[model samples]
Every structure is written in structure tokens, then in C-alpha cells.
Target chain A: MAQKPLQFRLNGAEKAVFVEDGANLLDVLRRSVGDLTAKRGCAQGGCGACTVLIDGVPGLSCLTLAETVEGRSVATAGGLPGDGSHPLQEAFMAHFAAQCGFCTPGMLMAATALLESTPHPDRDQVVHALSGNICRCTGYEPIIAAVLEVAGEGGGGRS
Target chain B: MTIHRGRGFASINYPIGMNLGGDPSQALVHSSPDGKFAIALSSIDLGQGMKSVTRQIAAETLGVPVEDVYVDTADSDTGPHCMGSFASRGTHRVGNAVIVAAKEARAIMLEAAAEELEVNADDLETDGRGNIHLRGAPDRSITTGDACQAAQFRHGKTVAGRGIFLIPLSEVEPETGEMTPVSCYAHAALVADVMVDDETGEVTVEQVNSAYEVGRAINPRLVEQQLVGGAWMGLSHALYETTEPRYPDRSHGPVDFSQYTMPGPGDIARHDIAILERPAPDGPFGGKGPGEMCANPIMPAIANAVFNAVGVRVTALPITPEKVLRGLKANGGARPGPRR
Candidate 1:
């Protein structure tokens, strides 16, 4: 294990941060990287609270070693269209699905990724793709509706 | 949404089978006997909006505005073993206890109201707005405010309620698979039409139509939302979620959320949700449990739909691509069932 300087873009801005060896991107992003939207839920990648994007693809920051993603493009839930005002976010609020708000980030990222691959993803596709993220509230209806709305608009995965 | 009212009371019922976690003395919280406020916060919001449901239950029962009904679940000290928010039992069971407690507290409030109006408690009834009025004279009603004032100042009185009631749920029989305990029960049917690639076992859930029998929908809007959420879980669990390692390990069950997939936004189908309320005999506000049952049958419904479309039945938790391919290979490519 070795310490090194890691350079990457957070929320679309270039930044340099020091990374300790064997540190998951989650720890570095929150503590060293100074971005707290990537919350520490289960921390072992079991919970999707810490999900961030690597190269526009949804990846669990908790499992990605900080050094491995150095000099690469990294994004978080903050980078998503709305600062909590995106269509997805709006849908979440309207449907009351983001009850606890803990799992929303992970859910958003995963949904963002799904829309990337398929614009008007149907219900089965949405359900299959988001199966990785866990929510304890509002079940999944509203989330499904939001994604479908975005997909229908051909907004599949971007701001 | 058709609310099938039952005599006495109603419950939102379902057999509990979700895999929930508990960190020792956490998750499950309760109140004490000495406390004046008899309350229970939903242990498992289960994304069902139960925090608000519990508050409403207590408020309605106590004949007070929801605000006056203090449903506190601050910390471990203020509560007893509160099962995590997973099942759709929040309003039914916790609300039942709260209702009983609130009813007791309301009785106390009514007693004072009776003394003030110079009428017997039997001659008084609480208006839905929490005002106690004599049966003959609706205009001569005492607000809960006045009653409380009389109890505290004029009568120098005190009253409180406390209790915890866990839904008596029974497990499905190992041999027959017949579920018992039957605390609260809800049945739902979901129809999912999916698009699967012959190359990959991956599936795209197209449209979904769900029907549930919630004993009661205290909040009709919330029930629909929670059902949609549950449908997502059921769909995801049937198609993707697994507790086994990508490799294999008995010591540690699947690592957590990372290794599994739950239904996400893209995964949602065109939804047609219908709430059928068969009010249980004991649910709060004539409402039975509809939360988890919405998720329970989704997998089977989806699986059945997939079978109907492509002609295969992948029975494991998630009807994954690999399994779909296997089933497809076993047959031809697609079997016919029903389309969503």
C-alpha cells in the first residue's frame, strides 16, 4: 500500500486530492475529496448511498480504490441534472418515494446508467437494472414512473 | 380503489417473509407504561409512508388533530423493540396499539368533557374533529382543548395510555407451504410483460398491472405509492436479487446491496394499480395491510407473464438471463402465457 496524489473531476470540476493506499473512493471522496453527497451507508457497496460515476458509468465509489480512479472523470449524485430538482428528483418528491432519502442517490445513479443504454426503457428493463439499489420506502412505483418519464422524453441518462 | 369495509375494525394484513436485519437492540423501539403518550412509530416505513400513517392513526383515534397526537420514536429510550420497516404492518399493528392507546386517552379526554357539559360520558360523542358533543345538541360541543383544560385545571386529573402489540404472524408450513398466524393478509396479482434478448438472459419489464387487497387505505394515495414500491421489490427480487455470492459462500450471506439488483426507474412497467380493500376485522381505521403483499406476488406474476410470452418458468428468486436462456433452451425459444 502506498500514498499518492490522485487527480480527478468531481461533479464536473477538476480537482487534485491525496489518497491513502487501499482507501475506497467513498472514504476519499467524503473525507479527503470533501464531497459528502456520497454518504456512508453500508460502506461495503451493499447500500447504494455512495454510488458515483466513473467515465459516465455508474460504479460504486465504495469499492473503487481512490488510486484506481485517479485522473479519471468522476461524478456523484450532485452532478445529476437537478440539484435535487431533476425530473427524477421531482418524481421522487411527487410520489413520496424518497421517504428516507438515504437510498435516492444510488437509485438515481443506477437509473441514470440504465437510461444511457436504453432511452425508453420499459418496466421490466427498469426493474432489472435498478435491482441493485435498495429502497426502504415508497416501494418502487414512483421511481419507475420518473425513469419512464425521462426515458420517454429521450432524456435517458443525462441532465 | 374499492374499499371493502368490515365490521368492527380493519387491518392491513400480509404474511411476513421479507429478509430484514436487526443490529442487536436497534431497529425495534417502543414506549413505556408510565408515559402519558401511548405511541409507536413505524419500525419499517418500508418506503410505505408509515410515519405519517402512524401519526394519523393516533390522531384520529384520540379525537385530536394529528399534531396533538404526539407519536414520538426519538431514540431507543422512547421506544421498545420496533421491527424494522419492511412489512406492511405499520398502520395495522402499530396503529392498532396506538389506536387502543389513543382511544383510552380519548376516553380520559371525554370524561373531562362530560364533567364540563354536566352530561354523562355516555351522552357525549366525539366529533370527527375531536370535539365532544351531546347527541341531541351538536352546537353544544366542547373542544378537546376545553376538555384538556378542565382535566388539568378544574378537575386536577391525569390520564395516559401505553402498550405494544406485535402482529401475530405465522410462518408458511415447511411441507404444505400453507401460511398461518394470519395476523393480516393481502393478496395481489401483477402482470409484467418483458423483452428478453436471446443472447443474454437479461429482461426488460415492459408493462405492469397490479391489484391488491389492502384491508383499508387510510391514505389512498400512500397505499398506491407503497404498492408501486413493493411491486418494484417483488419484480427485482424475482428477476435479479440473490443472497448467494457471485462465487459461493455459506459463512457470509450475499455481501449486501452491491451484489444484488432491485427494480429501478427504468425497470418499472407501465403500471395499472388497483387497490382492493378487504378490511380486516382488526386493522386501524378499517385498514388491513397491503404493503408487502403488493411485492409478494409480483415475481410470480412476472414469471408467469414471461412464461406466457416466451414460454418458460424460471422459479428462482430472480428469473435471470441465464435461467431464462436455460428455460428457453429446454423448450424452443418462447412459451406462451398471458401478455400484460
Candidate 2:
């Protein structure tokens, strides 16, 4: 397979990479681009650990072919503002939304897309939006609370 | 068009650490020349916040800020030996070892500071801001980094400490098969409320309330996460997960998460947890770990609830719809079978 120069905007920088056809954007970002934030959990779309923002939309990077991302903007957990400045990141830490942090990147990315789309989403909407991401730790309560907190909803409306 | 409601209860307990007598975790604490420190241990974090908890313990003992301490859990060959992370002993076992090591290192740091300040080692105290000063005198102090330089160059002493936590062997009485297997045990009780649809043979757990005695929570948030995650795991085990569904036939076994079912966000129940603090006398900082105890009681509780709802007993793991329907058909959902 011939490799092609796949160029895309990552975080805030424009980057170009040589990727073979059928290579996944996850591998290109992690191996070729040296960004290890996006975890390689399950590799299959089932885990959703490789979720990333493609044009501000959450997509499973593992299932995405590298060539398809050419000229598209991609965002990841590392792209979030440093020092826990992002509302989601601060909310995550404040609410103890992360444990092990293996799934944090994907969860954060998924939540980022959710918050962008539905700023005042209800508990069910948050759950539905985060259905694709799986976290073995923190059970999803704190994660849900963090998202809701960032939404200024005083946490999820769970009784 | 009928939904049967039921409730069930279960109580369980789990040992804190490995039962083996030689289950030991070792830690090595060393100070950097810049007054920062690192703890070398063989215990892997496994995303359970082992690194953070152990770091807090080390910093507390060393009288340093938490930010000044770093934990390196990589390379078991280079780091001290740990009995792996599965035994739920990472926090209790490794934390004790870190306390011992940090205490030793703190003594060395104080001695070095005393040398530079020309003060008695016993009279010096650490202010936790990388500074050492005499009691009742905040104005006169020396930086820990400066003391480290003096210790190495002037006193020719190294600032390091080593520690290990080991449990004594409990001899088993052959007749009764009884032994003190672990130093302490964490206890939990769970109540599961469910609704069963007789027509579809489906079970939906509406809510779960649990009480856990974790001895002590080094980090309350981390404990809650473990409890919540563990309950989810137990729910999956009781209602969804199975290695060999068609038992004795390996052809239809699930090979992946997609094939093997687990409850997603939509299926999760409302979980309410009540933490009971009963300090363990022998535990580190009066803390008995809660790693594995959270998942112990969920299965039996859910199974009991299913039986109460439909008056059918499921004796096997994962009370799947097929099993529920089979149980219902066998007894016609008239009377509950003998409880397991």
C-alpha cells in the first residue's frame, strides 16, 4: 500500500503525517503524531476508549481510517486548556470524575461533544450522549455530575 | 401488561490483603537534591488511585507537601517487591511500607537540617514547605534543598529510606480449617429493588442501596468510585455476564465485549451508598482497604430480588431472561422455589 501525506489540524496546530491506506487515525495520532492521550483500549469500536473530536463531533478514532481525516480538525483530551482550566476538566477533578484516568481522555472527548451540543442537557441526555464511552472506574455518577456541574445544573437531577 | 416489583437483601465480607504470610510490599523513599522526593515501589496503580493514595501517605509521613512527592510504580525489577495489585492490599499494605520509609527519610532530612542550622536534631521540625525550623521560631529556618547539599557534601550522608510490610503466617487448625487469613475484613450489605416482567421474563433493577464498612477511606472519592464500579461489575455478573452460556458447549461463548453483554449507562440503577467508618486497629492510618468488597453482595441481592418478584428461584449466575422464563414455566410463577 502506498503511503500518502495526510494533513489535519490537531488541537490547534496543523500537522501532516505519512499514513498507509487503511491505517486508523488513532494509530496515526498515537504512534505517528506522538500523542499518547488517546488510549488504545479494545481497538474495537466496542470500548469507545479511542473517542476523539472530528470537526467538533465525537467519533471513535479506532474505527476511523487515517486518510479520511485529511484536512479535518481533530481534538483530544490533551488539547483541553492546561492547568485544569477547562470547565469540564475542572468539573471532572472537582467531582472526582476520573479514576485510573485510562478512560478519561475518551470520556472527556465524548463529554466535550455533548456539552457543545446540549449545554443544558438533562440527566438522561447526558447518559445517552455518554453511552458510547465506558468507564470501569468512577462508575459514571461522578462523570455525569461533572458534566452537569459544568452545565451549571447543580449536578444531575438524581434523587 | 403487568410489572412485578420485588426487593432483596444480602450481606457479605471480603479480606483486606492476600492470605499468604509472605504477602509483603516494599517501598524505597529517596530525597532529591532539590528537596523533592520519589517513592519507588513495585505496586502497580491499575487506575485505582494507588499512586495518589500512596503519595499522600508518603507526604504526610515525610512532613512535605503532596506536590513535592512523586511516586514511581514502574519496573518491578528495579523497584521493591509487591504481591501484585489484585489482593486489594495496595493501599493498606503499600501505604504502611511508605509510612515506614518516609519516617526514616524524614529523620535523615531533619538530621541534615540540624547540621546546617547547628541546632539539635530533636529540636528541629519540618514546616511542610520544604523548610526546617526550630520550634516556636518561624523566622529561623533552612530550606530542605540546602540541607540536602550540606548532608551530601559536608556530612557525606545519603538521604534515603527503605521499608516493607509483611503479615505473619496464620497456622491453620487441620480439624476446623480455621486460620487468621487476613489482618482485617471489610464488610458490606446491599439491597436491590427490581421489577420483573412476567411476559418478557425481563428483570430491571430500579435501585440499589448499600452500606459498606471500609475501616477508613484514605480518599473518600476514590472509595466511592470503587464502590460504584464494583457494584456495576456485580450487577453484570448477576444479570448479564457469562463465560459459557450454553454450558459444556464452547461454540457460542462470547469472544468480546460486544458479544459478552454488560449493562450500559441506560441500564444502570440508582445507587445509594452509605459509608461506615470502623477503624481497623492494625491497618495503616486506621484504614482497611475497600477494593474488592464492594462487588461481593450485589449478585445475591439481585438474585433474591428476582425470585421475590416472580416467585422463581434462579440457582445459577446471570439470571438471564431465558433462565427466568424457564424457572417461571417450571413453577408457573405460583410459589417461590427454595432459596439458595
Candidate 3:
């Protein structure tokens, strides 16, 4: 294992780091770049806790090779405003969507991709979009309601 | 070839806390010169809103605003002794300790205000808006911050209190194998509606309705979160989750999330919850623990639902499709149980 240099736009800022060959994007982002928001839940892509936006599409960072993200835009939950002013963050707080918050970053990344692509996704669409993400807390109900609230759809009343 | 729909019901009376040895939780309440309160404890939150609910309890007991209170749960070495946060004892046990500590600290705070106002401490009352006032006189008052400052700087008194809650261990009768297990109990009833595909043996949970009698909800939203998430976990354990599908040969246990199966967001059922509050006398603000027991009733309810749908009684966990199919075959096809 030799280490190589990888450069990419992370959260709208150019980030350059040296990563070992076969290293995953999650490890690089967490260990090398010091961005610890993207959690390594399963590390096998089955649990989407390490989800990140690769060029506006949600991808599991644990499954992504570091070098493959070279020169590409990698968006993480850290990309959201730190002031807790992001609409998703506000909605999550208002709806009590997070508990322990280990899966929150990935859920936010996945929802970010969905809202960016389809601004007004329906309840089923939200469920399908978040199907890949797993939350052991909150039962995915409040999370769905939070996203729906941001999309101007009120809680939608139990579908 | 047909999908059979059936409903089943299950109820449970769950104990609140473990009575192993002696279950105890300790809390320390102290105030700064600025009147901001901090509660120190060793109980871990574990994503169940332990800190938030305890803060609410402390604020209520101290007669102060919630925003002025903060909870610090340092490690065991730094904080007070706790029986840990398992057995759903965080709310019932730890909250009682916080209440005692906050009451002691509030007494000292009122005493200091009484000294400054030249009135009897018994005649002073907290307005819960950060002010200590005379019981009958509305205009005669002093801010809690000023009271704290007077207590610390002028009176040279520390506005702090220590509290510990303990349920003495119940001695077991060796001959009878009997013992008092817990202090209080929470009750729940759940009805699961499921669809079983007779041909494929796949079970889909269509809807779930549950009612919980949690001795008073300290925070209703947190209780709701626990109920919803616990039911999902129950459903997962009922139909999908298993580490050893091929038991007795422990060769291929799941090493990752891919092998370990759980219900995804798409597999979630429509759940409706009704919370019934019956305050426990020994509970803090009449609140009991609602963490672990919320998931208990759903597992048996789902198992019963599968039995009602296909007349297959699955005694083992996960109730896998293969087991359902085998049970159906043994019973000579899908024998739907009589509807209740």
C-alpha cells in the first residue's frame, strides 16, 4: 500500500488529501480530511449511515473508493449550515426527528439529494427516497414528516 | 396463490426497573452565581432523551425555567453513581433523584432570598419565572440570579444539593423461588394487521394500533418517538432479523448489515399510538420508564397475526417465510383461523 494524493471539491471547498490505495471515501473524509460528520455505521453500504452526495447523487461513502471522487464534488452533511439554520435541520428539530443523531447525517444527505432533484416529492416518494437510509431511532416517521414539511407538505397525516 | 389478511392482539404489563442487587441513580444539582442550574449524573442518554426529560424534571422541581437548566452526564469517574441506563430505569429512577436534588437546591435558593428580603424562608415562593417572591405579596420579589449571588457572595453558602434514589433489594425466598422484581409497571396492548401470501409465505405488516399506559408522559413527543421506533424494532425482530438462520451450526453468522436483516423504510407499517397516563405514586411527577417495554407487545402480536392469517404457529424468532411455508404445508395448506 502506497499512499496517493486525491483532490476534490468537498462541501464547495477544494480539499486535497493523501489516501492509501483501496481506501474508502469515508475513511479519507473522516481520517485524512478531519470531517467526522459522515459516520461509518456498517461500512458495507447496507446501512446508509455513510451516505454522501457524489455530484448531486447520493452514494455510500464507505462503498466509494477515494480516488474515484477525484475532481468531483463530494457533499456531506457538514455541507449544511453549521448555525442550525438549514431548512432540513430546522424541520428535524421542530419535528423531533433526531435521537442520538448517528444516522442523521446520512438521512440528511439522502434527503438533500431527493429535495434537489424533486422539490415537491409526495409521501410515497419520500418513503422510497429514504428507504435506503436506516434510523434505529424516531422510526423514520418524524424524519419523513420533517422532509415533507420542508417541501411545503404538512406532515401528510399517516399514509 | 391468495393473500390472506388477518388481525391479532397481544397485551403486556412490563416492569419499570431492574431490582437486581439495589437499583439506584444519583444526581447533583448546583447553581452558579448567575442562577443557571446544572445537574450532574452518570446516567447515559443513549438517544432516548434522558437528558431532556431529566432537565425538565429538575426545572420543575427547582421552580425555574427549563432554558436555565443544563444536564451534564460525564463518565462514571467524574459523575455520581448510577445503576446504568438499562432496564428502562432512566426516567423513573434518575428523574426521582434529580427531583430530590433540585428541591434541596431550591430550598437553599429560597433561604438566601429570604435573608436578603428580611423575610422568613417559609414565606417565600418561587414564581417559576426566575423570581422568588413573598407568598401573598406580588411586588415583593427578587430575581433568582440576585438570590444566587447573595447566597454565594454575601451569605457564603453554596447553592448545591446531592440526591440518590434507591429501591432496596427484595430478598428472595429460596424455597419458593419468589422475589419482588420491580417497583412499578407499565402496560401496553397492540393489534397487528398482517397480510400473508399463502403461495410465497411472505408476511407483510399492513398496520398496527397500540395503546400504552405509561405512568404519565414526562415529554409526550419523546414517548411517541420511543413507541414508534420500538414497534419498528419489534416488527424487525418478528419477521426479518436473525443472526443465526441456520442454527446449531454457527458457521455463517452475519458480519455486517447486509447479512443482518431488518425492516427498511419501505417495509414500515402504518402505526397509530394512544398514550394513556396513569401516574405512578413513587414516580417522579408520576412518570415511569417507557423505553424498553414499548416494543414488547408487537412481537407476539405479529406472531399471532401470522397464525391467524395462515394457521401457522411460529414458536421461533423472526418467523421466516420458510417456517411459515413449512407450517402451512404441515397443516394442509392455508387454514385461516376464525376471526375474532
Interface C-alpha root-mean-square deviation, candidates in order: 3.9, 1.6, 1.1
Residue B22 of model 2: what lDDT? 65
Q: Model 3, which residues run further than 4 Å from truth?
A: A153-159
- Which docking category, incorrect, acceptable, medium or high, applies to candidate 1? acceptable
* Stretches of model 1 off by over 4 angstroms after superposition: A1-38, A42-48, A51-91, A105-141, A144-159, B1-46, B75-87, B136-139, B163-180, B245-259, B332-340
Candidate 1, residues B1-340, lDDT tens digits: the string is: 1111111111223553232331111122121222223354435453456667887776676666665555556554456565655455566666666666666667777888899898898888876665779998998788877787778777877655554655444566899988545455666655566666665666777777666777778888777776776666666777777775544466566665545554444445566788887777876777866656766666666666666556676667567778877887899665554433
Local accuracy of candidate 3 as per-residue lDDT tens digits, A36-88 = 99999988888889999999999999999999999999999998889988888
Lowest summed lDDT window (length 10), candidate 1 chain B: B1-10
Q: List all candidate RMSDs to the true structure.
A: 8.8, 3.5, 2.5
For lDDT, the strongest prediction is: 3
Q: State the weakest 10-residue window (summed lDDT) of model 1 chain A.
A: A132-141
User: What TM-score quantifies how close candidate 1 is to the native fold?
Assistant: 0.68
Candidate 1 residues A1-159, lDDT tens each? 667888988887998977787988989988886777777787776666777779878888888888888778888887766556777777666656576678888888788788777877987888776766766565566676677777777566565
Worst 10 residues of 3 chain B by lDDT: B245-254
Q: Per-residue alpha-carbon lDDT of model 2 for B15-54, expressed as tens digits?
A: 8887765678899999888888899998998778899899
Clashes by residue pair, model 3: none
Query: What's candidate 2's DockQ score?
Result: 0.55
- The superposed Cα distance between candidate 3 and the true structure at residue A156, in angstroms, equals 16
